[model samples]
Target: MKTRTITGVFFIIVMLASLLTGHYSFGAFYLLLGLFCQFEFYGLIKKSGYQPNYVAGLINGALIYIAFAYTANTHIVQPVLFLIPVTLSAVFIQELFKKSTTPFQNIAFTILGLMFTVMPFTFFHAMAYVNGDFNFHLPLGFFVMLWSNDTGAYLTGRAFGRTKLFERHSPKKTVEGFFGGLLIAALAGYILSIYYTEIEWKQWISMAILISCFGTLGDLVESMFKRSINVKDSGGILPGHGGLLDRFDGLLIAAPIVYSYLYFMAT
Candidate 1:
């Protein structure tokens, strides 16, 4: 328990520091995070006895993240997006050199890793740059709402949990706890809307609901994967947190959907 709390605190500090520091740190931090998540995903896939093209997947993921980060900061939509396909094609081309048997499956998992981890992160990190600058409100508010949901769910579940939310995938989750988390997240969103002022309070509340709902689904999805593999945690990097994926699973599912909402609202 102590180790978990300490690691959690350390992660929060680093995340906030990097986010608030400036664009460089923010970009660098998420870029590194994206890589780690991708690496971890590929590692998990490898354990399943499928030989994924590790180098190709890692390189392509880095390319996708860096390209998005570059375009986000400068607010310049350049030809770089085009280059992603060029690198992605390299993934297939490089597979020919490998002596592995399941070339197509390898390529598929490689791409899946990029889609599952890199894409959402790109959208999530880009949220802070909609105003042509590093506005902390969107990203910071997201974390607040997400953390609120997690904390609320745990407490509420412990206190009044009865009905199973998704027992097959995640046996511990309860329907009562899920609603409690949503309520808490909504409250946090309302407060954040007041302080951030970038998004209306109503929209912020909606965003919180989305975060809670989709985030829970995301957790279920990860749980499903872990269960299929007969594993408890993704990795041991975070001590009490299980793994980075265990921590960001909700963000993985929420970020892209939330980005779409914000985009339409802004448009």
Candidate 2:
């Protein structure tokens, strides 16, 4: 408990400070986070009886950074959409040199892993780099909503949980907790919408629901990965939080949704 409280407080403080600063320094923070996630992902895939090249992982990791950088620095939509295919092909080609094991599964897993684990992070970059004073706070709004939902569900479920949400996948999750989280998240959305200037009330509420549902799904997805890999946690990079992927699993799902919302709004 003490570890979690201290870790959580410090995590929030650092993340908020970096994000709210609205500068290239936040990019540095995200770059480190994304790289850690990539490392964790490579470790997870290795459990399936395959070894991913660090160079390959590094290349793929850099692609994620570049994709996010495009949103921040340039206008390269076509390459962004084409990244997964390109990266998958590269992985496939790499398999040919290794006469030991079939690379098809590795390629497929790498592609899927990037899509599931890495792509949504680009949204954070997009949010950070979005032009206009009002738009600057959008990412922070998503962060607050995600955190609120997480905290609310945990506390409420502990207090009044009866029915399990997904016992096989996530034993601790509860339907009661899900709804409790939504309720609090909705309230947080309302308040944040009032304060954050750029987004609409409906948009905020809708985003809150999206984050709650998909964030839970993200947690379930990570849980599935850990279960399949026969691991308890993703990694122990964070003090009380398991790893970058473990902590950002919810954000992984929510970030893309938030990004899409903004993208469509832009178009």
Candidate 3:
């Protein structure tokens, strides 16, 4: 309990500070996060009887993140998208020399790593520039809703959880907890609207619901992968919180949805 509490507090502090500091801090933080997730993901895949071109995958992931970050920062859509295929092509070329039996699977996982890990992080970075300027409100509000949903679910699950939400993938989550999370996340959205009035309460509430539903699914998806790989946690970087992927699984699924919501709102 003590370890979890301490890690959670420090994690929150670093996250908030990064978001609040400026674009540089935010970009660096998520860039490193995406790289770590790719590393851990390839590690797991390798453990499951496959070689996933870890070096090539990491390089590709890093380039994808940099392309998005650069565009978000400079407000210019450069031809950096070309760099992705260029980097990914290296994986296929390198695979031919490795003599691995599952070369095609190796290439597939390498590309999938970018989609699974780096793309969502790119969406997350875009939240900071929702209005063509870097204001802390949109991203900050997004995270506030996420945290509220997580807290509400945990508390409600412990208090009144009976029926399983997804018994096969995640046995501990309950239907009651899902609704409880939505309710509290909606409240948090309303609170965010009070201060960060750029987006209205209705939209914020809608986003909260989306976050809750998809975030829980994201957690279950990660569990499914870990179960398939015969592992407990993704990694032990967080002491009690598992790996970066374990902690940000919710963000992985929720960020793209929230990004789409914000983009449509802007359009």
Report the lDDT of model 1 for residue 237.
89
lDDT of 3 by residue, 1-267 (tens): 899899999999999998999989998998988888988888889888988888888888888888888887778986987877777789989988998889899898888888888889989998888778788788888889888999999999999999899999888899999999889999999888888877778988988988999988888998998999889999989988888888888888889988898888743
Q: Model 3: runs farther than 4 Å from truth?
A: none
For model 1, how does the per-residue alpha-carbon lDDT over 10-109 read when each residue is reduced to its tens digit? 9999999988998889988988898898888888888887777778788888888888888888888767788888888977997898898888888898
lDDT of 2 at 247: 89
Which segments of model 1 are wrong by more than 4 Å?
Answer: none
Please state the error at residue 199 of candidate 2 in Å: 1.3
Instruction: Give the whole-model CA lDDT for all candidates, comma-separated.
Output: 0.89, 0.77, 0.87
Clashes of each: 0, 0, 0
Please report the TM-score between candidate 1 and the true structure.
0.97
Ranking by lDDT: 1, 3, 2
Between prediction 1 and prediction 3, the one with superior lDDT is 1
Tens-place lDDT digits, model 2, residues 226-261:
898899888887788778888898988778877787
| Comparing 2 and 3 on lDDT, the stronger one | 3
Q: C-alpha displacement of 108 in model 2, angstroms? A: 1.7
CA shift at 45, candidate 1, in angstroms?
Answer: 0.3
